[model samples]
Target: MADLLDQKVQAQSLVDVVAERLEAAIISGTLEPGSRLSEQALAASLGVSRGPLREAIRRLEGRKLLERTPNIGVRVAALSLRDLKEILEVREALEGMACALAAQNMSDEDIAALEGLIEAHGEQEAVREGKGYYQESKDFDFHFRIVTGAGNQRLEQMLLGDLYYLLRVYRYKSSTKPGRAKEALVEHQNIVAAIRNRDAGAAEGAMRVHLRNARRYVEEQLVEEGEAVVDPAPRKTGRVGSLR
Candidate 1:
């Protein structure tokens, strides 16, 4: 019984490590979207057995990060321009509300930690060079912190669990636009300042503005690449107006 439990633990740990490694590669653009994945090659490259690698692939597949087709094997999932726009629209609404809730719910220590994250991002080499933003994963991102600070389990599952990696893929691409990293850093500061002041309306407004700008940037990039045409107009919505 003890050996069986140990074996189960070891197998799960191996799966976890393999999943994380593959996720990192996908997020880093090392594994391009829609590119076919060679399981044998992946297993060899990662120095893992086929069993664990296949389990990792299954987990990512369930996350919608990978796609499997009959007789065609597995490939990384690619988001079309329309798909990206739709996701961004939903994210703008959801994360804006999250920022508002975070402003009301987060303690002083949480707010301070959020500010420190921004500070650390500002000092990153890629950010300083105007090359890219600093978010490598949910753990290190400013928006992720605010969403977690909202203290809503359902919201956390939706944003952090469901949409996080998909958004990270496009967010990294959007942040590569010239001067976008610095602009986004300033936006992060504005968000943090509003949260620190406990101004829920202002926090929500700042978050919406930031995400809307990101949507515009992504649209522009897609247009430039001749991938898709996106409507550039911002949708009008009712204001939160002083949620103190």
Candidate 2:
């Protein structure tokens, strides 16, 4: 019984390591969207057995980062422009609410730490040179801290789980748009300021505006690239819509 448990633990650990590496490659664009995966090649590249690689692939499929067809093998998931636009819509609402809660719930020290993170990002060479914003991890770190500070377990899970990983796949491309990095940094500063003041309303409003702008930027990109066709109907405004 003891030996069986040890073997199970070892297998799980190997799966985790393999999953993490695959996820990193996908998020970094090292594995392009819609690229086919060859199990034999991947197993050889990672120096892992087929069993563990298969398990890792299954996990990514559950996360919507990989897809399997009936006859065609597994491939990296490619999100449509409409899918990305819808995600931004959901994030604008949920993250705005999260910022409001963080303003009320986060400790002063936590807010200060967030400020320090933003300062560090400002000092990065890419940001200083106006070449790009924070790298994937750094950008996610800023949002992750705020989401965790909201003190809502379900909300944290929703934002920081699979959805977060999906967004990371495109976040690098989005941050590289002309002048967007600088604009995003200023928006982050505004959000921090509102949270520091413990003004929930202001924090929420600032977050909504920031995300709205980001959504618009993405829409423009999609239009320019002809990835999505815009509707001629007037846009509606009200409470944020549901992801469902």
**Per-residue C-alpha lDDT of model 2 across residues 1-244, encoded as one tens digit per residue:** 1111112223448988788777767765557566677787677566668898899999999987888876667777766777788888999899999999999999999999999998988987777776666444533478888999999998987888777876776665456578887888899999999999999999999989888877787577656755453442222322111101
lDDT of 1: 0.77
Question: Which residue segments of model 2 deviate by more than 4 Å?
Answer: 1-18, 41-52, 134-140, 223-244
lDDT of 1 by residue, 82-201 (tens): 878888999999999999999999999989888888999999898898887837566587888899999998889888886687678678767778999999999999999999999999
- Return the TM-score for each candidate structure: 0.81, 0.74
- Angstrom error of the Cα, residue 182, model 1: value is 1.6
Question: What lDDT is reached at residue 244 by model 1?
Answer: 11
The TM-score of predicted model 2 comes to 0.74
Clashing pairs in 1: none
Give the best candidate by lDDT: 1
In TM-score terms, candidate 1 sits at 0.81
RMSD of every prediction: 11.4, 10.3
Q: In model 2, how large is the Cα lDDT of residue 222?
A: 56
The per-model lDDT (C-alpha) reads: 0.77, 0.74
